[model samples]
Target: MKQFWDFGMEQAKSCIFPVVIFLSLAITKVIHLSLIARYDLILIICLVTQVLMVVTKRETWDEVKVICVFHLIGLALELYKTHMGSWAYPEEAWTKISGVPLYSGFMYASVASYMCQAWRRFDITLGNWPSTWVVCALSAGIYFNFYTDHFIYDFRWVLKVATLIIFHRTVVYFTVNDRTYKMPVALSFVLIGFFIWVAENIATFFSAWQYPNQEQGWHLVGIGKMSSWLLLVIVSFMIVATLKHVKGKMKQAPKLKTEKTSF
Candidate 1:
């Protein structure tokens, strides 16, 4: 029994990323209708796994702090947007957009755990100069509002394949950078999420886009969601900050012997 437990842990440690992917896919499927129902269990499993691993690590304080910033920022932004009627998801997941349930935080963390791992493997860095824009543009191209809100839930099969490919490549490219200051990078993900939040609100305001059943997602304050657009640039700066910190650390050299000789 102990050996079996050890084996399981080893496998989990060795291939947690693949496990996360498998978990998200398995979670996203829930046929009988409700958004959180049938689909919520997968989120639990994914988060439980990350929690176990994160607890085992000693240096998680900074990471947790950054994630908390994301959570607060997300909640505030969502509450602000809830006033606008810009976008919505199945209300089953939330009693109020202003008060998104706690599970939402866990959901973000679960996906974020996988993203941190992927970014490390991709070697993608703000240090790459203009290449950083490529990541954002590509993410927008693939994760377009229309597809995730409508297509993935119903016509999931089509999305499954494309997502698998794109997500795999994205993880690979981003995870390539070994010298990473994790907190900033994680915050960038949160910032990106915020950008998406604002973007959806804008589209809905213009009547350029709308989701079929969701009513719990899009919300901004009296200001148009466009007001939050600057967050995207902030996110980019955060990424660059992480790159600069990591690069500086790497370039720091150990002290060498220096002596004053006596005659």
Candidate 2:
């Protein structure tokens, strides 16, 4: 019981960015802003929130860089997906490009931020991690399928199966307080994806954006979307893992130099 409580507390701490964003969404929905557009206001809030996190030592610069990369990746997908009519930002804003608001990318960034925070707070490490090339190949396929599927065949299910096979042996080890816990990496992806899907429903409920069906009225987002989020969460995880791996290698470089000099 105590371990569960500690785990929940750590998870809540890791969710700071996402909670701020959701609150901004809900608050902006009901308030009237004369000078700034609602979308632009949200963008400002996100930027400020990120800066504050860095200033307060809640996030490292490297983590911020990773989050930025995810932001761009997500924004590009938004541009294409919106053009394809998958979903849309119906509100008018100066910060919008080709109908998608810039703030939308931060929604994706928030996911990366949560992963980074949780990793640090939980002292996370991976076991039986796959080789770099294999991980990159799978990540690339998953991302490209998000685009290519709209034009050609939807290879998501194929990619999903591939994910399970590739990561079947990988385990995530994380510490909660003094105790440590482990879970299958694939299962972690599904759990994070499920939560993101729930967050998506809340975002749409607050009129953050609208789908075709929601244009008439708001309703629960379909369960099928969880599959998409699961794949996306995998991609996000692989990217963070790669960056962390690179950083770990870089940190060992000076140690290797010192060892050689001592010999």
Among the numbered candidates, top lDDT falls to: 2
TM-score for candidate 1, please give it.
0.39
CA RMSD for every model? Answer: 15.1, 6.7
lDDT (10s digit) by residue, model 1, range 1-263:
65346534543454463345354544354234454543244446545655666687621554455445544544454444444554433324433344343444443343334334333333334322224354445434433332344434533234334333433322101221122221233334445556446544543443222343324443443343322333333333334334435445213321222222100
Rate residue 150 of model 1 by lDDT: 40
Off by over 4 Å in 1: 1-28, 31-43, 56-59, 93-99, 106-263
Lowest-scoring 10 consecutive residues by lDDT in candidate 2? Answer: 250-259
Q: Please, what are the lDDT tens digits per residue for candidate 2 over residues 91-130? A: 8899999999999999999999999999888888887888
lDDT of 2 at 169: 88
Q: Model 2 RMSD to the real structure?
A: 6.7
lDDT of each: 0.40, 0.90
Model 1: ten consecutive residues of lowest lDDT:
170-179
